[model samples]
Target: MNKLSKLALSIGSVPAWAFTTGIVLAAESVKVNPPKYSVVSVGALLSGLVSAAIIIAAILAFVYLVWGGLNWLTSGGDKTKTEEAQKRITSAIIGLAIVAASWALIQLIANVFGLNFQEGITIPEIQTNK
Candidate 1:
């Protein structure tokens, strides 16, 4: 087939494809359930993200500590390797400390300001005349 004929043939099938797709979609009666929790505002999203970050940081810190311990155990009396492993352990401890301190600080600020981080912030909506 020539280019023009091929293009014409392809274009002619578009309506048939659309009709088939519409029929198939109309044949199904799908029900969607409402979500248990809905994110109503950006503040809620940020709060959720922070909570997830805290959990991830804690898990990562634990993994790093265990990895450092294994490295140290397998160092086999090498001073350089031992030193590296010690640094890793120190870093992991520092990371864990930072995460804890930040969480404490957030809690303290929340208490001082009477802001509820757990429930997240809700901005008042401004309604306009339709």
Candidate 2:
């Protein structure tokens, strides 16, 4: 019912209270620090990636499933090959779905763990470079 929880719900994520840790750990990483992409940015990026992956995988799985089904129907009762195609299509679809869901699940878990889960509202430190 607070601002943070409202913001989280608006952003389609779990309530901030669920995650007790503040996720603003600002230690420099070994690799390049890519322009202060904070928790909100990372969450948005992750959501986008997961959604895209789900759409793509769903499309691919559907195409293969349809192809396999039609091949089976048109094969004139070819039991052996038809079964093989069916099995392959089924496996592919299941695998793709699992992969897509896995990413989404990971994102949700990370949110619950309070990793990369802050609202983007931090003022930047003033630079004094001469």
Candidate 3:
């Protein structure tokens, strides 16, 4: 196989190898006394993941904007390069707007359902019979 094909194959296998390793390690480190899983905990985990993804996307959009600005500054009167930089900036701005809108939508939906996104999930105490 060619060098490029070999490189592609290696890259494709990396995630599989990492996943297998993680599974093996996790199995070996199994806890004797695991914490009880609850719907509230799952909801909290999902909420945290969604929040993190939105924050990461926003950060990436800002980085893209900065990169586009740098490109524009270094274009030096080249029309094509300037246009490309402008497009990049426009795309970044649109992405940021979409992220903001998604966040707002999530908040609106949560409010409509009477769920407090900031308060996190609340687990109810279970009383045991004596």
lDDT per prediction?
Answer: 0.89, 0.69, 0.86
Q: On residues 1-130, what C-alpha lDDT tens digit does candidate 3 reach at each position?
A: 9999999999999999876733343345655754564334766777777888999999999999999999999999999999999999999999999999999999998888887766564545679999
Clashing pairs in 1: none
Q: How accurate is candidate 3 locally (lDDT)?
A: 0.86
The per-prediction tally of clashing pairs is 0, 0, 0
Candidate 1 per-residue lDDT, tens place, 1-130, comes to 9999999999999998887733343556778775778776887887888888998999999999999999999999999999999999999999999999989998898788777779985656889999
Q: Identify the candidate with maximal TM-score.
A: 1
Name model 3 segments beyond 4 Å from true: 1-40, 121-130
lDDT of 2 at 104: 72
Quote model 1's TM-score. Answer: 0.71
lDDT of candidate 2 over 1-130, digit per residue (tens):
9999898777765555566677687887678565664444545665556567777877787887888777777878788978877897787778777877776786688678655422422334669989
Cα deviation of 42, candidate 1, in Å: 2.2
